[model samples]
Target chain A: MFRLILVAALACVITSKDVLAQEVRITPDTASFSVEVNGKLITIERNQDTNHKITNEFTKTSRPCPPFCIHPISAAPGVTTVGELEVIDFIETSVAKGNGLLIDSRLPEWFAKGTIPGAVNVPFATLEPSNPYRDQILQALGGVQSGAGWSFAAARDLTLFCNGPWCDQSPRAIRNLVDAGYPADKIRYYRGGMQLWLLLGLTVESPNA
Target chain B: MYRIVVLIAGFLIAVSGMLFLQGGQRDPADFALAEDIVIEDVAQMSARTSQAPATDLSGLTSAVRASLSPETVAAPEEADDMAAMTSGVLAGLGAPAPAPGGDDAMQQATAAVLASLNGATAPTNPAPQSLEAIISQSMQAGESDAYIDALLNEAVTSGSVQVPEALMTVDGRVDTRTLIAAIVQQSMGSADAAEIQAIAAEANAGTTPRAPAVQEVAGERLYTVEQGDSLAYIALIFYKDSGQFERIFEANRDVIASPDKIRVGQQLRIPG
Candidate 1:
């Protein structure tokens, strides 16, 4: 009887199937990926432009990969995409409350031209597109800083903007974030670029000042 | 006796074989990474310690360089301490806490807002436990509409709760808990009710300047794209993504056509 039971158990174990096949998903699912030599990671969205090249090159700014490193990524179905207006409102309120940074998805030169005040610029080109640099960028952006002085961490309520609604800059940058494995809800894109700001008569400054 | 021993041995052999097969089929790659885990914890330590502002690397460039070389990553003990320092710094600078008396004020203010709109306590379903826990968990999950009815029910079930007819607004369209939270947080530490009134007036008016404070942005470089500037390639040069490039492109689109097509030296606006 015991032998029969053991055989039955083995058969059940072999036949009971629930696991599913995995696929290669990009880090910043919405952007492109470039791997750097130092095992650093860098992600670039589709819109921003700059001429300053330091090191490394990639086919596209983002791409999907079979989840590597030490862990697995799982997701439940039926997640919803939150709207841009809600994110903008949250950022506006958060900024008023002194919460986090609103990153401008422009090049250093463009950043010099004009941008929302207190925003940081990280042109996606200079990062490694692999296991490490993705985290490094987060650390560098006052996202996750260290030392006796002040540090920053990127995991916050961030609202990103570039040109305008038809403009793909902010969306591309947001894609980088999404691909970098950040949840879609955490990122907010402002589709209107400087045009909307000018139209609204908010504020503008020349890059040379 | 031999037959019995053979049977026992066969059982053990079969179990061991099964275990081996199971282990073979189990791929370690199929694991989930909760946000906090790092890929190379030791490598992370070396990177942080090297970047530490206090570390003296001036006179000891060679030593610093050697330590940075992949082979000599920080020792286990040193890495642990450095990692701790890194985490401490992160925690210290991350998520600011809600202001003093903020929760109560938020509740009251939301109640007031709801009263103005609804005339009764905005109905909520009875939640399993606490509102605070639910909210916190929602924030962690990025959002949660789960058990909202329960939460409302619980709030209504609490005794002596004043339910005014005026609080019940037409269409049941009430202000959200988030709006009240924002309002109450802004009112914290105020010395005057008049100031609170004024602030509320501004909030209600919605004409308050929504943009962040302006800063100096002059003398920044200009990179106008001539026709055929691929967003990906441009992002590589800028160390940002093509999305950021579009920010530049759209900001200056009046001078250029599509982000895909731009003339050289278009005086593209670059933020300072």
Candidate 2:
């Protein structure tokens, strides 16, 4: 019986390895830099997918990428977090403060079902290669370390949170700010994220509800 | 019999396990209710823009005639004459309403037209006017908490609810707080019960306007919009559906005052 168990465990390990070998990896596990926009040190986050090749193949071949293969960027240097938190704590704090921003890194349905009160929707997939709103976000946080719309020289603080520690939204967001040169001190990350927040018994308002 | 029952149970468990494994390899959408971008829809938006001149001419001719006098062209003879004069009249209007330049702009204009035509159009732009060029276009008209709460309560009472969803890409770096506030404000601003009813009815029918769902970057959690970001392309990249740019603007209302005005380096809060 013990031998059988060992064999099964070995098979599971082999299966896991096989799955790992199937993914493509992107460089810069997390990109951090501060672009000097207007004059504030705006922080930014970038989560790299080391396994892009495998994912592409799977997607193209009409196969699903293995679960947990898509890992979210969680933390980096210069993130100031509000609570001993989970993602939900950041959201609750944001709501309690009645001023901070709560970001939902989950898809639309998750957002619609229930989200941290007053949270906005921004997805990680669209971060790079430029979109029109990048500068606007930096301006709100204060100034990009080096990009345009580094407008707003004032050092306004912001709290960043995502689905959970497993979620890459907060990390990538932080990286984007840091890369833009936003001051790290002004930015806080809620590491516990939404998974924790949901677990913490905080109320989530669904757009649909 | 007992042995056979145990064997059957074991077989069932094995089948369930296989199913789970198969499902585990399925797309995220299979396991969870997530947003998906429809590439065809995005392609369609761009196609529509390219075809804008043709559409605009037809629309303008009708609009001008409609505004002038229904009696003038209500008859078949007048209608024939009107059709004959349509091109000349439209040419006089000029430029045929430019295609909003990009997908985001187009989406913004479309939303505005829809709202206005439906009645209950708020100030065309809600953000402080100075920043109009840099802000994301208003997603929904602003709604007050009191009004939203009342609406929600009413929906609950009616045993139906209209929940709004973010259908646009999360690529833009707009303020999340500002976006939600904007949406609430817009919802609250919808003072016309009839228009509100229109939205509610559509939502309840499970026919929330079709838009694309956002996809995640491999191994990354965020993407910042740099200089040269256009709404259409962004929608294509993230949501795979460009028609949902208004939804994106609505989600990021704080930093984005106008969809056409995003500056480089803005940090957008990305939804999954």
Candidate 3:
């Protein structure tokens, strides 16, 4: 009886070890959760289509050059380059807390197509220094007006992205914001953008939908 | 008592033997081996660490890069050429010709404009109308619809006007006016200011008097949804009044379910 018990115990230990060895989890812990955007809670999950393929504007291989060339990893000094996971974490921590913004810097058409969950559309052209609406937008982004200048004391952290690495709209937007006196440290860049986000099988939400 | 002691001793020996064997089988990849189960635990830990955040950015970048096709990989260079070509075509349409000597792109653009104009006028007038003469005549004539069409057809036929594949409709036709506008907008600095103004005036002349506010090009006046576009915003762009978004919503009722929602890549009719 004692020998039989020992054999059974040994068998139990080996089975548990084999079971653990076969399990492989690749997604982040927060991936299974939901995120709140524009007063609605959106569940984050990859597109469930078993035969899913990227079929958006991002599938295009080229665009006008000079103005729309591939952007460098870093937009400017002090602005950190981040990927999808970091972007998700920021959405959870900063955006959900209302202390930061996830900015989709593409034009309205691109924004209308689809975007990463939790991102708000802010076209790069609308934020140009010469645009009459620039000051209004800056103020809305929590910039405070001081005497003869603007202060970013109350400004929320901003993470900007556009189509992907090959897109310059977000880089231009980031540079424009930094030039407009928004602090560089307060800005983070998701260099991967929509292309990488989709590639990694992350969720995308359309504003219209 | 002796039997119980022997059993305990046997268990110790078996446990020690297992530990000893595991120590000999230590994986070279492991940094430490505090427990017999450390190998599996370390693998899980390494995988968890990879999924944690930021540490494997290079790996992710490479994966994304690998997944992208070679066409996408070679896009930047092709984009520059396409942009130059687009600028050249727009310059040909009505914008001012680039300076006598500029970059290769500008030079090619100027040549393309000359070639297109030469082709358009070659059969009718032995001395081809200079780009300046054509623009001046079109503006003075105030007959932009026919004039622009003739010019675009000439350019398209000559293969000088290479519309990017993205701009092509399902039927493989391109929107000449939008193509012209995109090129003009993109090639702002390269084109002549007065010429651009004249072209804009002529283009707007045809659309402003139309009751439906549609540019009277050959087909339906359609606008593709761009990033950041809303119904109101698109209305503001075409109709100059955000309040007229309902007009667009009404026009696109078949495809559009909600006035507030518009998808990118959706073709919205700019009802006349």
Candidate 4:
């Protein structure tokens, strides 16, 4: 009888541990709350609709070339390509602290649809070297303009993202910023962008919503 | 007794092994349920709707017409004559009289005139143009390449135009300026030279000339780690052989720390 009891106890312990290991948990330990952006308290969460499937502008898989193509991982020698976690870290650490900017390098329409929390929309084209407003934009990003010259000593560290890995808007923006003399090391690339961001169950806020 | 003990041990081992196997086997139903919950939560959070906005054709026509200067609008006598001509055309086509003073009627009349000028039927299904089509249409409208460039630059800066995947190249890549140029070329094929010149002159009059192109130096190539990716696999993609994973490891030594360990979303440099 004692031997049988011992065997049963052992089985029970093993089974309990196995069950514990297999149980799935979905809720994040972090507190869910709204973040303030542009003087508005914006609540960030997944779409409440149970039928929400990803049908954003980023849904398309293909585009024409010579303009649209897969981007190289790094925009410049010092520019680091980061993932979602690093982007979140930057947001919590640098952006929240006002030491950096999380830029959504998509056009306004995409920004209106939804974007990462605390990101400011700056379309990639505005940073192009040929753009007449490029200098003004650089200045707004904290570049110091002098007579026919500029300095980026006070420029905020920028983390830029677009639709996702397949999207080139952010990459193009990064390249333009780099070419326009934005410090490469100060710019980080969030390659996962909105696609991966949503896939990972991170919070997104829509200005229109 | 020895035989009995051995048998018991074997039985225990088999039971434990079965438990372990069961533990590892995830129930698909459970996963589906969890996914459903996630979807439900997201849906509750965003309250997003799938219905597209209704197209206001009359509003669009009015906006277009309102953009025209007062000088551009015809005198009352000329307007009356044009109205008579429009009515004659409509009568000839056996169309009914338009509703008196209704915006819809005015919109129809304006649309008819615009259609006749373009030698096309009345517009139907007035969906907004995609960015690609808009850029193409701008080109066709005799906008100068410089003007279009400036317009695109302004639109991007203002966040009015988002990135369109249709502009991506076949290989799933995009060069922003190159894409703009291609769009212009595609649209310019049917554009009038005089209109293009006029728009170009107007755009040039207001804007500083574009600076000369600077020689570009190629920079380091990068690769983002993906799910199911290994150093060897990445090396094979870039080098066409797996043996050079060490080169990748060497380039990304700071971030990688070890070749055996890499995570999705980590960016690694591909050695030139």
Between the candidate structures 1 and 4, which one is better when assessed by TM-score?
A: 4
Taking every candidate in turn, the Cα RMSD to the unseen true structure, in Å, is 29.6, 27.5, 20.9, 32.5
Scored by lDDT, the top model is 3
Ranking by TM-score: 3, 4, 2, 1
lDDT of candidate 1 over B1-272, digit per residue (tens): 67766766676676666656555345454343322335555566677667534324342333223223232234432232223223222222232322333233233323322331222322322232554454443333223232332333345457313222211112221212222223343346422433433332342343332222223346654655433224322332342222345566556668756544444434556543
TM values, all candidates: 0.24, 0.29, 0.42, 0.41
**Model 1: runs farther than 4 Å from truth?**
A1-92, A96-98, A126-134, A141-154, A206-208, B1-272
TM-score of chain B of each: 0.19, 0.21, 0.22, 0.23
> Which should have the higher lDDT, number 1 or number 3?
3
Candidate 4 residues B133-166, lDDT tens each? 5465454434445555566555655666664432
Q: Sort the predicted structures by lDDT, highest score first.
A: 3, 4, 2, 1
**Per-residue C-alpha lDDT of model 1 across residues A23-62, encoded as one tens digit per residue:** 1222224233332211223222222222122232111221
DockQ scores for all predicted structures:
0.01, 0.01, 0.03, 0.02
Task: Provide all candidates' interface root-mean-square deviations.
Answer: 21.0, 17.3, 18.3, 18.9
Question: Residue B238: error of model 3 in Å?
Answer: 32
Please write out the lDDT profile of model 2 over residues A81-180, one tens digit for every residue. 5553333344344433433445554433234446655455444322222335454444443454454335335655556666565444566667766666
RMSD of 3: 20.9
Poorest stretch of ten by lDDT in candidate 1 chain A: A63-72
Model 4's alpha-carbon lDDT is: 0.58
How far out, in Å, is residue B93 in model 3?
A: 18
lDDT of 4 at A197: 83
